[model samples]
Target: MRYEKGRKDASRSRIMEVATQRFRGDGIAASGLASIMSDAGLTNGAFYPHFPSKAALVRECVAAALEGQSGQIAQALASGGLATAVDAYLSAQHRDNPGTGCASAALLPEIAREQPETRQLYTERLMTLVRQVSAALPPHTSDPEAVAFGIFATLIGALQLARAVEGADLSDRILAAGADAARSMAQPRGGAGQEPAETGVTIAAKTERER
Candidate 1:
C-alpha cells in the first residue's frame, strides 16, 4: 500500500510538471489533457486516476505554478528593494521563460472563462503573491498589502502590454516603462512619478530578442 501511494505521488508530480510547462507555454485552453498526459508519458486513461477532471488539473497546476514562482519572487524581494525586484521580474528572461515563470504573466487571461474552482484557486494564488510582496516592503506604511496589490497589478498589466507588441524595440520599451512604473509605484507617496531606483540591474536592461 505504501509503495502504491508513493507511486501515485510521483505520478501526480510528473503530471503537474508537464501540465505546468504546457499550460504556460500554450495557454491553458490550448493545452489539453491528452497532450499533457502524452507529454508526461502517461496514458489519457491515467489522468482520471489522479485528477477527477481537467478543471481539477487546472486548479492543481495553478497552485503549483504560483508556488513555483514564490522562490523567484522571494529572491527578488530579498536581494534588492522593490525597484530592483521589478527590474528582475519584468525582464525578457522572465517573459521568455513562461513555463517556469510567473503564472499571472502567462495564464491569467487564458483562464478567465474557467470554472469557479479554478477562479478561486487563482484568487488564492494572487493573495499569496500580494502577501509575499508586501512582506518585502518598508514597514513604515500602514497598508503594505495595498502597496503590494498595486505592484502586482502594475507588473501583470505591463507584461500584458509588452506581450501584445511584436517589435523587439517596443517590447524593450514596454519592459523599461513597466519597471519604471513599478518602481515609481513602490516609492514614497511624496515622491511619486519618479524614475526607477537605478540600481543598475542587468536583467532589466538585457536586450529583447526572439525569446
Candidate 2:
C-alpha cells in the first residue's frame, strides 16, 4: 500500500508540472488531460484518482506556476535592484525560454479568460511582483506605487510587441529597449526633494488620449 501510494503521489506531481508548462505556453483549454497524463507516462485512469476533473488540475497547475514565478522574482530581488533583475529578465535567453520564464509574460492574456479562481490567483501573483518592484524603487519618487505600475506596463508592452515581431534582431531590440526604459524610470531624481518627471503616462493611455 505504501509503495502504491508513493507511486500515485509521484504521478500526480508529474502531471501538475507538465500541465504547468503546457498551460503557460499554450492555453488552459488547449492542454487536454489525456495528453498531459500520457506525457507523464501514466494512463488516463490514474489522473482521476489525483484530480477530480480537468478544471481542478488546471487550477492546481496555475497556482503552482504562479508560486514558481513568485519565488523567481523574490530571488531576483534578493540579489539586487530592479534594473539588475530586469537586465537578467528581459534578455534573449529569457525570451527564448518562455516555457520556464515569467508566468505574467507567458500567461497574461490567458488569465483574462480563465475561471475566477485562476484570475484571483493571477491577481495575487501580480500584486506580489508589483510589491517587489515597488520596494526596489528609489526613495525620491513622489509615488512609488504609481512608478511600479508604469514599470510593469512598459515591461509587458515591450515584451508583447517583441514577441509579435518576426525577426530575432527586432525581438531582442524590443526587449533591450524595454529594460532600458524601465531602468531609466527607476532612477531617483537629484538631491533632497526634486520631483520626478511625469513618467507614469502609460503608452496605452497616451495613444488613446492622443487619438
Give one clash count per candidate, in the order shown: 0, 0
Total backbone collisions, model 1:
0
lDDT of each: 0.80, 0.78
Q: Write the per-residue lDDT of candidate 2 for residues 46-82, one digit (tens) a residue.
A: 8888899887887787677767766776787788757
The parts of candidate 1 lying over 4 Å away from their true place are 1-3, 191-211
Displacement of the residue 178 alpha carbon in candidate 2, Å: 0.6
In model 1, what lDDT does residue 90 have? 91
TM-score of each: 0.84, 0.83
Q: Pick the candidate with the highest lDDT.
A: 1
The candidate that wins on TM-score is: 1
